[model samples]
Target chain A: MPERGLLIVLSGPSGVGKGTVRKAIFESPDNDFEYSVSMTTRQKRPGEVEGVDYYYRTREEFEALIAEGKMLEYAEYVGNYYGTPLDYVNQTLDEGKDVFLEIEVQGAKKVKEQVPDGVFIFLTPPDLTELKSRIVGRGTDQLDVIEKRMEIAKKEIEMMTLYDYAVVNDSVPLAVEKIKQIIKSEHLRVDRVIDSYLKMLKEL
Target chain B: MPERGLLIVLSGPSGVGKGTVRKAIFESPDNDFEYSVSMTTRQKRPGEVEGVDYYYRTREEFEALIAEGKMLEYAEYVGNYYGTPLDYVNQTLDEGKDVFLEIEVQGAKKVKEQVPDGVFIFLTPPDLTELKSRIVGRGTDQLDVIEKRMEIAKKEIEMMTLYDYAVVNDSVPLAVEKIKQIIKSEHLRVDRVIDSYLKMLKEL
Candidate 1:
């Protein structure tokens, strides 16, 4: 039997380019991990698929999943509920595909508490200056906007202590390469290795 | 300041081509790891440098290191002493180079007790059939040799649980790729990441 896939939670502060790194890593069809599609109450925007982008659910349908304790971690933003569906993650892992959850630091810790097997990774910027540049690169010069982001970045950086790994987003390609290596190496972890070898050799 | 290097203990059963895998990974100059030059009382063979191949030492000097508790792991085979020096490993790591110690499973456990921070990796063969083929591939048909080696392989395979990671040596190049990935991923471990970012960001 094939080994079950890893549950990976990739998180970072804003302006760390988490989405860009994710897109780059998954750009190739050969990548084996499964990107988690979140369940949301928000209406679908243009060019969004039903299940591919988000599992859209009505208020009752979403509440039913919460009552069933299937939501790994959920929060309401702007009167819309959004959460990770635990069953989908388990199903994907059962299919032998590593699951990737792109989340904020707080959600990462919350998901980690629920699924301790998840590998929590923090993507850090090279420095505060680089982070500020990336934040402003999104197109803005407002003083308060940059200051507020810098403040949030400080708190999120401290949350890295709870993570299992930290990779600097020095270059998008390099960061993606490091993440790929991490996922590959994690498959070689002793506990994660299949017991078939032991069983086969022990009979000798 | 640069990050401190990892101390890696790579062990495997006989006929697993551990040495071949090691050489392939370190063949590239870009690899930052250092191979440990062992101290031994054995006579230097041709093409072996004093410190490069082995730190040639007299029997009395080798005993002194053993008595001083300076040898990380040592064994007296054929009236010749062979052992790893703790000081050399520390000096290389202090110079920001990862140290690789290719030893047996027993020596790995012994060294791990002294340096608990060391990363232990076990290399397993593809299967017992592959192992037997590799052993026979060495052009030895002696029943006693094959039987003795098979017995030892079974024992060492059982000890794999003591390792942090296990890579299957299905092919030399692929095994080397897996080992390289393991080393690269290890550097991203949370505890090893420097707090420079934290201190710098908090001052904002």
Candidate 2:
């Protein structure tokens, strides 16, 4: 039987480019992981395809999944719910295909509770100064609002201690390369591959 | 001060091509690690250099170092003493230059006792059947001797569980690539890198 696939969780504080790095990983022709499409109550944007961009759901539908614990982890923002579908993630992994989750820090924390074995990668800005600049570069918030955002970012950065790998997002390509290295290395970990060797030993 | 560099221990069963793979790594133009030159009482070959190759030593001197607990790990083979020097490995690591030790499985186990944090990699033959064939193909051992070698190889393969990563030596370049990934990934592991991130967070 094929070995079970890794559950790769990519997350970071706001504006750390988690989405961009995740996109680069998918755009690479050689990437084999199945991106876990999230279910959301938010309106689908133009050209978005169902089951591709997201599994759009109504308020009641999302709440029902939560009630049934079908959502692996969910959080509401602006009166809309977003979460990972537990069944799809499990099915993909059972098929020996890795599942990649790109989510916010809060959602990542919740995912950790249920899937503690998942490879949690916390992507960070090069430093807090850079992170602040990225936030300010948005050019969309007031001084007080930016300070509030920085405060929230600080709290999320502190949560990095809970992660298994912390990658500096110094550059998109470099970050993607490091993450790929991490995934490949994780596959070779003794605990993951020893059982196959043990079975081979028995045959020998 | 810079973080201490990793002590990379690469070992596997006899005939698994550990030496060939280790040579490939060092031969690579971008390889940055300092190879830990082992001290040996065996006569140096015609073209061998003193420090570049083995640190040729007399049997008496080798025994004195061992008695003083100055050898990191050593073993006597074919009436010749061979071992890694403890001082060189420690001093190189303290200087933040990674030290690579390519040794036999028995030597690897002893090094593990002294440096438990070292990244131990086990290189394996594709399978025991293939391993047996490699032994038989050597064309030098008698049938009974071949069987005895196979027995020793089996025992060494069993020691793979003590390693952190195991790469099957199906091909040299692929195994080398996997080992490189393992090293880069090791550098990124949370336990290895969290302190800098914590200090950065404190400053923020």
* TM-score for chain A in each prediction: 0.83, 0.85
Model 1, residue A128: distance off in Å is 4.9
Error of 2 at B161 (Å): 0.8
Which lDDT values do the candidates have, in the order given?
0.82, 0.87
Alpha-carbon shift of residue A169 in model 2 (angstroms)? 1.1
For A20-133, candidate 1 gives per-residue lDDT tens digits of: 988898895668898998899999999999998899999899999999999988889899998899999999998888999988776788998988877888998766435545
Proportion of native contacts present in model 2: 0.59
Going through the candidates in order, the fraction of native interface contacts each one reproduces equals 0.63, 0.59
- Model 2: CA > 4 A from native: A128-157, A200-204, B128-157, B199-204
Model no. 1, DockQ? 0.47
DockQ of each: 0.47, 0.44
Alpha-carbon deviation at A182 in model 2, angstroms: 1.3
The best candidate in terms of lDDT: 2
Cα error of candidate 1 at position A70, Å: 0.4
